[model samples]
Target: MQKLAGVLQNFFNQAHAKGRLRRECFGNLIYYRLIDDSQPFRRGTVIFEEGTLIPGYPQIGRMIRLDKGLKEQFTKPFWAEEKVDGYNVRIFLLGERLLGVTRGGFLCPFTVDRLPDLIDERIFSDHPDFILCGEIAGPENPYLIGSPPFIKEDIQLFIFDCQRKGEFDYLSQAEKHQLMEHYSLPSVRNFGLFKAEDILAIKQLMMTLDTEGCEGLVFKEDVPRGKRSKYVTSDASLSDIQAMARYLPDFPPEYFIGRILRSVIFLDEEGISSTHELKAQLGSAFIDGLLKAIKQCQREHRVYHRFRCRLHDRANARQLLAHLARGDGHIQIVKHRLVREGEFYIFEFDKVFQRTTGLLGELLSGEMVYD
Candidate 1:
């Protein structure tokens, strides 16, 4: 079944070897280069083979890190609310039509930044097998805002994952909330089966979701209380740069990502010879928001939020890679084998996977790791 033109001609006859690229062409769709240029992909993103075209989990509710002694061991009638820090979306309905992705995998190109708001895109690029993972949040969106501002953000879809029609696996957590309230899609305020004396009340409800900016709490064990582990992400950012990357010292590895980019001073401030041109126009607009926030945090594989700058030579690196390749947005080539000599400088856009190659087997799974 690999006929998409023989899977786009064996994905560009192997992306580029010797120089190690093999694929990167755009205009049709392609992407693969898993982590060469010296590995560095700390999380997830790049999910194809099921209908790619992601971006959906902006969120609205169900992030309530529950646990007051597992709330009386959750006697099966559960539902809690309000626990936001922002961003974590997903929405994909099958028998009706809807699609989105953002729990790392992106695809939203602003349409009021959609969410559980499906209108039909074939649930996401024509399906074959079933699918419908969800998350997008805000405990409840009144409207919108960003950075660190909010009057009330918005977005919430939270379905979790259904992939097939086994209705909801080995059930029980009150039968997966009566099959997510008979497919209304939004269940999990309470689904406990706790023991070990509820891990110190779910670690004090993850320190009350890190003192309310929420971002921490996940300890799955739900398979009639057994088979559902490894699913946790909530330290949304207690930020102090994780205690300064824990006592920084030679802290520039993981393919270098500390992009403050412009600052003769002011990572926290330190430079004012009569406000030297107001610190060079606030270090060139924080080095243009550190190259547009490192192309939006390496397009989702956050890589523990790193992004540095301050390079140019090579004729300002072909005019900053031809001004980030004449923007329209599309930059996810996080550090591909970077290296530099003195006065240090590195940019490595890993040729953005030759240029795009059908998104490289959904970035790394197709061709299933060289089959």
Candidate 2:
């Protein structure tokens, strides 16, 4: 620990001066979280005082054109897995304690509190050094406004990759599958192997998933040190626009523009004509979403996404709320947000999109913009 701290002192000092590195405590654990990329360390990198380091999850490049992207990106057979639409988190065992760290390098109290219901503790007991990377998705999640149609109620964890404590490279697909099967772990569905030339098969799969309202696929090469790329379904892009249209001003125009372009390309590539139903779906995604936002602002004087989750401990719920309060003026936790329901505590809150809320409020109240 002393040596590692010494090695990191210069970088830490520079990062601290820039307000990019943050030192936070989770109970007895003292750690440093990188709020932004600083030289060699990426944003979301977490380093513990006791020498445990959970590196930030790397961003996977997206493929807009599968035919060209596959041939250009991969030289060998690759395995395709369903890309679940949810927040990303890394779960690890720290001195017999199971903890969930979010993509932003924060120790999530909500995820930690609900870990028992998501995974078997025996996997941690067996492999204490394992860093399980996965997605936490469903309606009951506190982070996302949208959830996959498959999960009706509570959230579920789908393990997609595994890494050792000190290693940067992920385990191969087969190795990950072996461990998952042995531990009876829930994982993303695999769509089998495909070579670069298997464009027709992949297109068929993408269309099938799009029809079912599921997200796209992530293609992982089978080699020991292979690369990965992601491709989302047109429906997934539309869903994103539909869900986030209420907070449209909060996001860049590029966000919606990029999705629109992808949908157009996807439809053209699949050789599908723009039918009336398809055009109506696209139009309603924006119109309906904006209408809902307007109504919500008129009714409540705010535009926000409501989030709910279950926790085993009330203290963790408080901790989660406190952590959120430390962020920018986006999260709003009411007085009675935490309620004891049966054995577990039901925690609820709202993620307020301040820009959209303010704009809508002014417009509704007859305010005029010069621009």
Candidate 3:
């Protein structure tokens, strides 16, 4: 299954770029929820048969709501590492050629050229089929956050997750360290394991990285599934907002409004009592730009058609789509269709104003690394 998945991944990747595949119409990151043979439930229509590979959307957390007892949830153990404020690049060793894929699985030229030299050739030899996932960062990253330009040597490929060549299965922490040591590749700063009850301490630790212009911290489990989540800094959030405005001028009003609410939520989570302080920190220009973008989006909403998407789980899909439509009052589900394929329930949602920018955003966010 893993081998086939790898082959299919590479094939679809190249095929989609050449306009030979229609799967790109669905989204940038095609997720396949692989069903087991032993399971009683019939499998849904998916590109892959092994496991799910949903889009590259980050799992956002509620800062204030989770603060109450969320800190105690990690009493067992969790691995934390500094989140780099750079583009996500997944380097694959395919045959003799190295491909740098963006979060959306598109070939990236910038990462391919800039990062290959930094990796030791012998590491590829050891793991013939391996996926080295990391952030291509530094002052000269040339993406996302802009900083002072630096030499090529200054650019860093901070490997965070080492996975099986095509599949998303991650290597153990010890294995990752061994691989990094063998190749002499630098990694994101690791905070090791923490069992402290004080969530405030974790926040403080993240703040120190923020002082250094770092984005945030990613938490990983020690055991199976290796669930990963991130806590981003306000500075990082602001950068993302600005990037959205500068790049995606036609995005819906809901997107900007969502970010605005997030801003307020994050500020309140930080215990800021004064509205004046929050307003001053957010800046009038930033707020004004978002408001302007919202108005523009509102104007566009008046002339939109229903967007559609297919999903395997009906209830969950409705909830997720409804959640996405919250910020922008314009986007709403007009219809829902259910197709029963054996025992599986296939869901289809007709939404107002479907945009392909979701995939485009993921693609353009990083430079293509290819031949």
Candidate 4:
């Protein structure tokens, strides 16, 4: 018993030294959760799986509320991340050549030629040693708030994901931080996971980041799925991808039913001009978008969205189409080639997101309901 007690104490002491907290020490206690590390890191030093790799990560986009009534359906929160305003570069090895790419995945022309020898020469020769995922941030694209876009003399990389050769997830979160420090690499965060159980806290953090010019938050929890999954399940307000997709400008029509509100939503600063003068000018714009959406549906019936449609009175085809169109905060109009017969029309909100709030705002504002 004495020997066991000594061992447990030694283990806890070791964990504490490595930036872990001894949460609740009970009888013969032994357990820990990694604490946020205290250090500086560049972005892209820690890479997480993107939505494209959506497998075991069902939480990536699981759950749907297509059956909810029209009045209550437009309020789901979307699990959005700041589409980091920099080149979306990838770090991959081709045979022996490892390289970075433009957001479009192209081996950036100017970047390839001008990369500092310290970065290019080293990374190019040692490509097999690590996978570098970062952005060419400068006055071109500011990843930090209040920072202007890329500047001539100010180009650096922010590594968000770190994939070391053969070593992968073998280390605890703390160990990973230490390794990043050891390599002298710049990463996005110095800490591992920052948990926010309270919704208010979430909102505050999001607003601060948003106002500061930083992109949205990147939440990580221990949910056993991917880095982005666990939070999606534990947080219902975060998985409203479908609801937010409708207002998108270029989204497909076959994706929506009745009438299509919008083909796609743009996240530009101007955002949706609004419910701006819905009386006539804005209303006409909204109607125009809806009509166009209807015409699109008639031409193509394979939209990426799947909504539950019930044909009836209060939910009449035309009204349903109009309601859906209204939800988008934009408008689309169908031409004569599409609509035919009866006092009927098709409607589809698709995303139903508020242009002003973005999807997250709708979730917080009680505008878009989620499951």
Give, for candidate 4, the lowest lDDT window spanning 10 residues: 50-59
* Residue 229 Cα positional deviation in candidate 1, in Å, after optimal superposition: 19
Give each model's whole-structure lDDT: 0.35, 0.87, 0.54, 0.34
Candidate 4 structure quality by residue, lDDT tens digits, 1-371: 12224544464356457645323211222223223322221212221111011001011222121112111322323222332334545454434443444442223323433344215344435445555555555442211111212234335566555455323332334544565566665545432333333444544444444344453344433332234421111011111222323344443444442122221211111133553332343234445544544444445532223232222232234433442343233333221122322432222223222332243333444685657
- Over all chains combined, what TM-score does candidate 1 have? 0.25
Clashing pairs in 2: none
Off by over 4 Å in 1: 1-55, 62-128, 132-160, 163-191, 194-200, 203-215, 218-236, 240-371
For residues 1-371, write the lDDT of model 2, one tens digit per residue.
34366667676767878888789999878888989776567788888877788878888999998899999999999999999999999999989889999999999998998888999889999889999999999999877889998899989999999999867788888899999999999999999999989989998999999998899999999776588999999999989998888788777799899999998888877878755777788899889988999999999988888888888898987788788877766545453488989988888888887888888899989999998
Q: Comparing candidate 1 with candidate 3, which one achieves the higher lDDT?
A: 3
- lDDT winner among the candidates? 2
Assess every candidate by TM-score.
0.25, 0.94, 0.58, 0.35
Positional deviation of 95 in candidate 2, in angstroms?
A: 0.5
Q: Which stretches of model 3 miss by more than 4 angstroms?
A: 1-66, 72-75, 138-154, 242-248, 273-278, 284-371
**Model 1 Cα lDDT, one tens digit per residue, 1-371:** 13224553344234234433322222233433211231122122222332332222222222232333334344433222223333444444423434343443333322123442423343344443334554344422211112222224334444544433212233444554655665555543442445535556555554454345454333434444333322112233213123222212213333123222212212222222465554454444435534443453346423222222324243433343443344324433344433464653443443232223233324443354354
**Over the stretch 188-302, how does candidate 3's per-residue lDDT look in tens digits?**
8788876445567776786566556567777776666555656666655655566455223346667667667766666667665776854765564366544544454455532
- Which runs in model 4 stand beyond 4 Å of their true positions? 1-83, 92-98, 102-105, 117-127, 141-154, 164-172, 190-192, 222-225, 229-371
Winner on TM-score between 2 and 4 is 2
Deviation from native of the Cα of residue 300 in model 1, angstroms: 26
Show the lowest summed lDDT stretch of 10 residues, model 1: 34-43
Ten contiguous residues minimizing lDDT sum, candidate 3:
36-45
